[model samples]
Target: MNFFIKLQDKISEFKLQINYMKKFPKIVFIGSTNFSLFSLKELYMKQYNIVGVITSPDNPIHKNEKYFSPVKKYALENNIPFLQPGNLLDDTFLKNLKAWNADIQIVVSFKILPKKVWDLPKMGSFNLHASLLPQYRGAAPINWVIINGENKTGLTTFFIEEKIDSGKILFQKEIEIGKEETAGELEYKLKKMSGSMIIKTLEKIMKKQIKPIDQKNINSLKYAPKISTKNCRIQWDDPSIESIYNKIRGLSPHPAAWTLLFFHKKKFVRFKIFVVKKILKKHSIPIGLIFNISSSEMRISVKEGFISIIEGQIEGKKRMNIKNLINGIKIRKNLFVR
Candidate 1:
């Protein structure tokens, strides 16, 4: 959710993509303002006439006293016209957007716009999605792709339509997802790719030569439902090694995947698993048992093998290597993680 995604194409190809946008006709960049900071800067470098920016209204921060505006910050820094209406469906928003007079709109991470808003631009209103639609379409496509163990995914620029993420694709470039890639990694990859793809799609439109590609039967579509605390909890009893391994890495580095454990005395506690390793199937041991412990290996019993917790953080403690926690905390033998 915090990172950006770029493509894995060659250096020459990247250059060409940037050039395509640099020579685009009038365009408007719309979407979640947080991820647009860097790309907005690049648009200015290319001297593209940014008719306006459409984003959600500013929100309050941690405390009620402080206010934060991610999109507004970027707009003010670059002196671009910005509209942050409270509701995208507001009549005022619709009326004002139409006044911008842009030939096309470049949507990145914004909410689903109404049909009227999507039709504002004369040429077309194009959106950049994190996944190669309609494979992964929903609120959290980047997270679900990595969670499902996808090898290759990329950004897609498509014409806006009434149905969500069901528009005709104008341009797409696939990027390889590493074996150990996390959701954070894929997000960054898609973010960067979308920026360049936006420019390329806009250039084709400038020349009035874009060809819409259908997405109805390209592949089976998967809905990427928003991840919550309930779905992120780790299940130690799972049999497959790959799924268990993914459970740890998919949520790694931010809002990390969690598991229930008992640390001190008989209290059940929650902890986040930061690192884990593969374990070959051996004779079954009691579930959640601390089967083996050594200066070298901190192994715990599972259905088929030992799931050794290499690194983690207790409910409120800072994350540290398991070796350090083992040395510092007094882990009782009868304690268990269920």
Candidate 2:
């Protein structure tokens, strides 16, 4: 009877292994940013079968230093398969990708995929976008959402399509934008939220419980194109203090909002503003005029209000608070920001 019991236990274990294999689908992940890193780690923790990762080619950290994308770094650390293809349409890359026999592909913060690549998976490919579908749909959704002073934004997982970000929505979770939240802060919050949402989406997809909705049916569609250098320049002449404040926060801490600081006639300095607050009390000072240069505070006047520069950096200097900046730099009498 002991021998029979041992044999039965072995057979039960074999059956359990078979069940697990059948339950988990072969998944391929495509991404390159911190957002992608979080999702990939979450999937691994949840025991998903991630067969391969496709990310952007390694770029130089400096003139000679090299750096791999966050997704590539994770894959290397975990010994998972990864590919960095310059062109997704390459026949050899396609063949190798097909060899994985992935049931589905999950894309996050990656470049736009070709149809041949996106359609390789037996089930279908999906993307995790950083904003609600049909609104803020483009490369710089996160920055634009905050720049536009949106009170509410969210993440959306959608079916891949030929057009950018205009895909069938699979799942969505709304996120609130704080009054003073910077784009960098919102990015962290969204990145953390994306992992669980993607897992939930996959579970529903596998269980045949999800129904993708067409984006065309959604209202209030707004496009968020890539941010340009010109776009990052703050227009102090604009009367809307609130809009200027939003622009400052939207681009804060990275590719920050900039303005011209005139120190001498026909010569000026470029100042990148990282943090500012709207002074509700109206001021009659001319727009873009700088005053009140103290150890801890500097104020620049706008149309109807003043923008207190809480944090900023000179073009060739390190970022610093107003106190440090004032202590180190001289305050010229004719200095003004435009």
- Quote the positional error of residue 223 for candidate 1 in Å: 2.1
Encode model 1's per-residue lDDT on 78-131: one tens digit a residue.
Answer: 788989888878888888887877778877777778787888777888887788
TM-score, predicted candidate 2 vs. hidden true structure? 0.92
Q: Write the per-residue lDDT of candidate 2 for residues 152-205, one digit (tens) a residue.
A: 999999999888888899998998999999999999999989999999999899
Runs of candidate 2 exceeding 4 Å displacement: 1-23, 218-220, 264-266
Residue-pair clashes, model 2: 0
The stretch of ten residues in a row with the least summed lDDT in candidate 2 is: 326-335
Candidate 1 stretches greater than 4 Å from native: 1-24, 64-69, 290-300, 324-328
lDDT for model 1: 0.75
TM-score per candidate, in order? 0.83, 0.92
Residue 65 accuracy (lDDT) in model 1: 60
